[model samples]
Target: MTANAFMSISLDPPLIAISIAEKARMLGKIQASGRFAVSVLASGKDKIAWHFAGKPNPELHGLFDSLDGLPVVRGALATFSAEVRDEILAGDHTIFVGHVRALNWDSNADPLLFFKGKFGALEDTRKAPAGMLQIETELMW
Candidate 1:
């Protein structure tokens, strides 16, 4: 399923979280299989994104590429296969917490992104790849 709500949840153990509507087909599959794969679509792959978002494509009928038995989108800029770590009920969505198992990435490719109400591409204003952004840790009173 196409995720609109997802984020990296941790740094030490490398975790990610995605919230899916409770009744979505993807949720059932995740529950049954105990695993799922995340593919970060490269820029200009909105067509592929829409295909997984429920629009049927006649030619590539169910053309899901796989690595280590996990279904992934071909040509993704980055991909990860993860085992389900936990499931949480978050109002109308079921949050699937995943523990990173296998990973792949291509830093040279720009990411496909959705913003506001439209699909977009990343514009690197910095003009160079920068390392992780640093934020000061908060101190408890």
Candidate 2:
């Protein structure tokens, strides 16, 4: 399922958390499998996102690459596979905390963002190659 409610929980042990509705089918799938993967879609991948969001575009299906033997969206900006470490009940949602097993990323692609109920992309201001943004601490205002 396409989700926006996820975050990095820790760095030391490489943990991440994702929240799913208590009644969501994916919840049981995760619980049974004891693992899950997150793929941060790149910009222009709205159709893929929408497909996973229950829209079901047949043309966008099967666009997955594997990480640690788990499926991740192809061409994703980043992918993370994890094994469930803990689960918490939060009202109508369940938060699953996982220990990251594998992580991969490509800085060349812009990220797909959902804000205020709309999909968008960040303005690319860097003129150089798509890579880590270097901080110039020496530059002054």
Candidate 3:
């Protein structure tokens, strides 16, 4: 039931969003709780990513630390404790959006990125392709 659940939302106001199955235990906790921590895993920590993705390990529970009454995993490249801003119903899943309230990080580490069903790290020195252009089209086109 794993999916591309991680995504960066609008940064101006510091917001993030993640999709969770309607039946997931985390859904209830997050919805009722109205908050959650976004821990950006450090490079080479695929196992840690899996644990939060529900890989099933008792020891994984201890990976997080309490900060300002929120839970965050120490050593994460970056951590943000966000308050729920919105919840949108999307078929069998719910999209939870949060506004960043607190944040901490080690600027030297690279962030773990999840794509195509696997986790990888962003290249520290790589820049975006020069002159890349973006095109926007209407949905009905």
Candidate 4:
């Protein structure tokens, strides 16, 4: 599923959380498998996100690669696989706390962001060393 309800819970033990609605199909899948993976989509991949959000986009089928045997978006900016460690009931959603088992990222790729019902990319406004900015963008696709 294309989840927007994810957050970092801790760094000491490398934990994260994703909120899934009680009735969501993914909830049971996570419960049964006791694991879940998150793919931080790269800029220009809104179609992939929309596809997973329940609107079928046949063009995006088979767009997954595997990490530690868990599915992740093929060109994601970052990916994380985790073991379900705890669950918290919150209103109509259950927050699944996960202990991160493995992770990989491309520091050069800009992240995809959903905001105000639209997808967008972040602006690089950091005041970094002149060559540093160019180096990061060199590998972005």
TM-scores, each model vs. reference = 0.82, 0.85, 0.74, 0.86
Estimate, for each residue in 89-126, the C-alpha lDDT of model 3 and write its tens digit.
Answer: 99999998988888888988887777777788776576
Off by over 4 Å in 3: 1-3, 58-61, 124-141
Please give the CA lDDT of all the candidate structures.
Answer: 0.85, 0.92, 0.79, 0.92
Model 4 worst lDDT window (10 residues): 131-140
Compare candidates 2 and 4 on TM-score and give the better one. Answer: 4
lDDT of 4 by residue, 28-111 (tens): 999999999999999999999999999988776679899878999998999999999998999999999999999999999999
List the candidates ranked by TM-score, beginning with the highest. 4, 2, 1, 3
Cα displacement (Å) at residue 10, model 2: 0.8
Instruction: Supply candidate 1's per-residue lDDT for 72.
Output: 87
All candidates: CA RMSD in angstroms? 9.7, 6.9, 10.9, 4.9
lDDT of 2 by residue, 3-87 (tens): 9898999999999999999888899999999999999999999899889888898776569999999999988999999999999
TM-score for candidate 2:
0.85
Which residue pairs collide in model 1, if any? none
